[model samples]
Target chain A: MNDPVAFVSAMKAIGAGLAMVSAIGAGIGVGIAALGGVQAMGRNPDAAPLIQTNMILGMAFAEAVAIYALAVALIIIFAA
Target chain B: MSEVETKKRRFGFKRWIVLALIALGVYTAFLGPTIFRPISPVVVLPPEGTGLEIFGFPITNTILGTLIADLVVILLGLSAYRFHKSGQIVPSGVYNFFEVIVQFLWNTVEGAAGNKWGKRIFPVVATIFLLIFVANLSKLIPGYESFGQIKELHHGVGYAPVKLFTIGSLNVYTIDKGQPVEAGHADEEHAASDDKSAAYSVAAYAEGGDELCHSCEVVPFLRGAATDLNFPLALAISTVFLVQVFGVWALGPAYFEKFFQIRALVRGGILGSVNFVVGLLELILEFAKVLSFSFRLFGNIFAGTLLLSILGALTAVLIPVGLYFFEIFFGIIQAYVFFLLATMFISIALVSHHAEEHH
Candidate 1:
């Protein structure tokens, strides 16, 4: 516990773990987006391609949040 | 009915093959010799130096990957150009394959951004998709991040190398389950530096200790290009810069109006002030776009590589096969996502603020 290097490394590990917690929000956002897209496709199956395209685009945007969190976690573990 | 029966028979045959393979995997995993267990790779964040230099510039493995990816893109382009020059009315073989991809991409671009702007943006978007897709998929090739120059590990812990064989002067080696070198043993070997036979002996490996070895490790010749931040960041910067260029080209000088709403502020009303603030936020969001674009691609590809390596180390056979397919799927998805975002941003930029307000 007295070793500063060990203490700092432990803190970084904890911080990296905490950063990934932000992925929960992105998970929910992506799920909701998928739900809406699937429902829209069910309602109008003829527009499936358009709906699918938009659905992927929305999921990418939502996933970007989790990607950001991952970046933060990696920076904490490696860069910092 | 005959066709259906044939299809069912083929399916059953494939199922048997799969089951036999899985059974073999189970046997190898549980009942195989200790040597069959793969050495867990030492994971490093930054790309390792291959000890090669170009005019004093040290070459990293990721750079090698980037060059390979570039070569693939160039060769494909050349092939496509040759196919076009041949003037085949009905394309076939490799040309047909290229045609399908190009046609699909063209339709997607044209659908997202109407015919006019889509034509202008298609080249850049398609190039991004092709380059990224190739770069990401290249990681799955055998021997990537595997075969490399063996360098003595000076600082960090490394696995004991098992000598595979010797050809002429070269002694080829692969790692075994990591056995740490004891401090006393290491020092004794260092003292007897002149005796080459005293170094890296089988007896040392046989007498394993709790202590870790700062021994030799392999620095792979090639790593996934997107796993490196430099490649992704460079691509993101160029993509964002092109987005701005497209905006300026479309809207003329008025494109600047999106970022700085001085006219709105000059109106001196509460709503006008809100509009001006929103424009400032838009400017910040443009910069944020660069970060998001780079990190999204980098994080996904890097995480995929890490997952693959860890899974491969844990179970050397059947499990990683599924993950390889998953990585391939993700490679395509990430490439398409990047392309789609770039196209969408360009299309958004093409529209005038006044037109949006009217809508």
Candidate 2:
């Protein structure tokens, strides 16, 4: 922390690492969504296409949080 | 009055066995040794394209890639038009494929933009989708980026040798009679052996002490267009600009009211002030949409390119095939998202406040 350049570099690295922690949340969220989708599919096979589309859309949105985290990490590493 | 519960579907025993076999196969594939030596893949920003200068303007590999995509699109369009004009009722080959794509895109846009505006915006949205889709998928073609010209390094030009996939020392070159000459020729009994001022140049791309005297660098001729920020930014700006123009054409002078809210301020009350501020905020949000739109597509596509290049550098074998498939899917989804977002913006603009209240 005494050296400004070193401190900033360390902090940036820490920030990038912290940003990736959101991936854990995103993973859990997607897994829960997929579980629900699977249960729905099991219960109503006829509504498979509609359910699958919605499920994938939801998963994409959820995964977007992870992508955001990755973008942040990239910016921190490169832009910093 | 009753919940008519459908019976739960279960996978058959044969299906379970197939799934298990596939899982095992994938696991074993991962367990196998890597095809190439493990190296920390370097990720560079603002992707380095071959700086090919044409009349003082440097054209990038990404631009070349875009040009290739545009050419492909145009050629296909011309062929499709010919096929249509021939009036073959039993559509086959390119005609059938073109019809299917166009019909699908039209239906999708029509659903989102409604029947009236859909016809107006279909060309713009479909063109963007097709161009991006082709550009994205074009990267997967073999030798699309891997083949290029090898440039020889000259002395006094600050060329730092970076690591390449190959493992060999570069051949050293020396100035012989004012020309770069390879040093290994013992048969040349030139009297220059006594000259200490002769400059020796060597190029090597790794951190090994065994450096080659003369090194050449490969400049890839093609790169994914979306991997560059310029393409996405230009697309986003044009899309948003077009949306605004369409809005003005549709709503006339009333369209500016969404941003300025002069009418709201003139009819002043506490709510009118809030509305005016909200209008300003909404205007700023529109610009933010441009940034978000460009960055989202640019980030996803660039990241995919980075991933593929890194994977390709790491292993020369079967590992990257799965990645290629995933990238293809991701590219298609991004194109769809971009198309949908543009349509949504236009539709949102088309729906004025007065029109909604009249309903």
Candidate 3:
């Protein structure tokens, strides 16, 4: 039960799983942005394309945070 | 209206038959056998192009992909040159397509750099965008990830290649004549002792059995170049290096002052100390940008390919198609993001501190 190799592997797997938890934050953030965009669109429809471009750009920035977490998870699994 | 409706109705039966045949053909060719007995798609984080040796130099599948990308760039360049030499004022066909893309890229650089630095920086930004875009989309080609040299592994011997081919294979004459070959039995004994898995060392295919082990394999070709860490890392390093050079060219010794802040450290006031520390942090962040840039592109593309292969394995029907389209969209977006980030970074470096403060 206390074997070192097995313990290390388990820890790595746990760390990777934990890293993925960041996606929840990113998901919520992007969802809120989209909701705001939808509400704004309802108020004024002429700014649709402008709103969409900004929304996508913002979502990409948000997604990059998640991607960074993924990179960390990958490093733990592969590099370690 | 009646005539048009009659004409449309006339081809309906034939069109449906053709569509059905195509659907059936696609099913059998790609996903039919895998449905009955699913195959686990090989998904490794790091690029492991089949370990092919050529004149003792290791050649990876990513290198092959990069070579193909270079060929494409060359072809595009050659045609553009030909079009220029032809002196055609009005372009058509492929040249027109090239003109539109180049014009769009130029507009982007011009937007970022204004009229001044756009011409100077246009080549690098446009080339990176084109290269990455093509490399990303290349994965969408049919049999892109599927076709490759498959390797068979031995269980106990632990990755003993049963059958393999490389550029070295073509130089069999040199290998035979240049070096004295050792005894087979002696070599086998040496290898077995090195691995030390004698208990499980039953020759899985000793009796001239099938060369390929069903499960243990490696594909040596057609992986997207951007999915490999080396390509993106190299690109990031070059971009960061060039950005710094551009900063120096634009601002001369003043650019170095932003990074070093020797004057701030010497002054030793509270603001000066803070500014100096921030300068150091900025220097560190510059290096960090390379890490973020390389990993972002590599991780996204690699994960995308893995997602696709997994999807194909898990389903026989329409689910994978949706993901395929998603990947296509993502490839374009990533290229655009990389382009924008690069241009922004360069432009940031080129702009002076006073100019920023004024704005």
Candidate 4:
């Protein structure tokens, strides 16, 4: 049988791996948000010009948070 | 009763036929998860040259896709329209939809570049938007991307070809665990095939690799065009550069003041730190803006393409059928947003040194 402490640590590593998978959620969220803005711009031609710049800005902020989460997960995986 | 029946009969057949065809196209191709058969990429390995040869690196498919998108747009504008018009109805429903697309683009550029300059950039922005949008949507087409033969190394394995044209045969190659690589193989092949053939090392197969890999088996053939950073990054640079070009055109030598407004703050004194910091922030923001623009489009489109592909492959029929329409809508919107934001950045960059507006 594997040592309890080592098994516990390995399980922690596995948990970290699963946490990194959260990037997938972030990915889906980001894509949906972007599509929502894109759809809005398509419907209203006049508003699109002004809204698009803001849309990109909003997209980047969302993506940045996701990326930061990814970075943390990566650190945990490597450090562990 | 007679008049009503006649009117319904006149239009019924044509509308149903068109809808049926659209439905058929979706069911067969966009049946995502159910489609076990592989699709081919719209742009494939170059039979000739690639951009991967600078110091010998793998040139990504995204760059190749961008090049193809640019060419396709040129050909499209020069030759055929996506939707036909004329005596039928003059700007059919599709045409009106696209006219709206153009208007959306115009509003974007005009809003960013202002009414005066927006009109000037409308054509360029629209072309870029439409071309990229179409290229993205093209990924949904079935049989568009497929695997091909194991390609030989060029001056070695470092450089990869860009455009890939699916050939009659897709030969699978595998590298057996132990095999020898022959030097001067091109010469060796010349002798074996009467000196007219290109040499391919069976070494990879010798170690154990499948023969016909779809543009590097790890990545799917039907990839979204914007997934790789190269296209968006190159576009960001071009857009930002154009902003400077217009700045010089409009403000002459004084354009330098936009970046270095050191003179404006001499009278303000101690708040000079704030001015200096803001100036640095602007400088940093320029690059950050480029990074954001590239990553935003690349990440969003790529993730969508990847999910649709994965989901479509799993379910095959119904689920993917619905997503195709959304993808079409998405393609147009993303392109417009990208172009609009670019126009906005450029216009902001070109503002006069003496402008009254203070942020």
Write one digit per residue (lDDT tens) for candidate 4, span B195-304.
Answer: 33222434424433433221232233334467655666677677667767777877887876656667757756768657656777776776766666665566556656
Winner by DockQ: 1
Error of 3 at B11 (Å): 6.9
Give the per-residue lDDT digits (tens) of candidate 1, residues A1-80: 98999899999999999999989999999999999999999999999979988898888788888888888888898898
For each candidate in turn, the TM-score is 0.87, 0.69, 0.77, 0.58
The TM-scores of chain A alone, one per candidate, are 0.95, 0.86, 0.89, 0.62
TM-score ranking of the models: 1, 3, 2, 4
Interface RMSD of 2: 3.6
Which candidate do you rate higher for DockQ, 1 or 2? 1
Sorted into a CAPRI-style docking class, model 1 comes out as medium
Q: Give per-residue lDDT, candidate 2, residue B121.
A: 85
Candidate ranking (lDDT, best to worst): 1, 3, 2, 4
Residue B186, candidate 4: Cα error in Å is 26
Could you give candidate 1's per-residue lDDT for residues B1-359 as a string of tens digits? 99999999999999999998877766655566543465556677787887779999988999999989889888878778888898867777776776787788899999988998889999999989988988999988988988886555655555566667666545666655546544355555656773774455434433331122346567788999998898888889999999899999999999989989898889889988999999999998888788889999998898898889888878877889999999999998899889888888888898898668658
Summarize candidate 2's per-residue lDDT along B84-152 as a digit string, tens digits. 788877878876776787888787778767898899888888888888888988977877765554444
lDDT score, candidate 4: 0.58
Please give the DockQ score of every candidate, comma-separated.
Answer: 0.78, 0.15, 0.44, 0.18
lDDT of 3 by residue, B216-315 (tens): 3446467899878898889889888988988898999899888887787897889888988889999997887787778778878888888887776566
Candidate 2 runs further than 4 Å off: A1-10, A19-73, B1-41, B149-218, B357-359
Kindly report the docking quality category of candidate 3. acceptable
The per-model lDDT (C-alpha) reads 0.82, 0.70, 0.71, 0.58
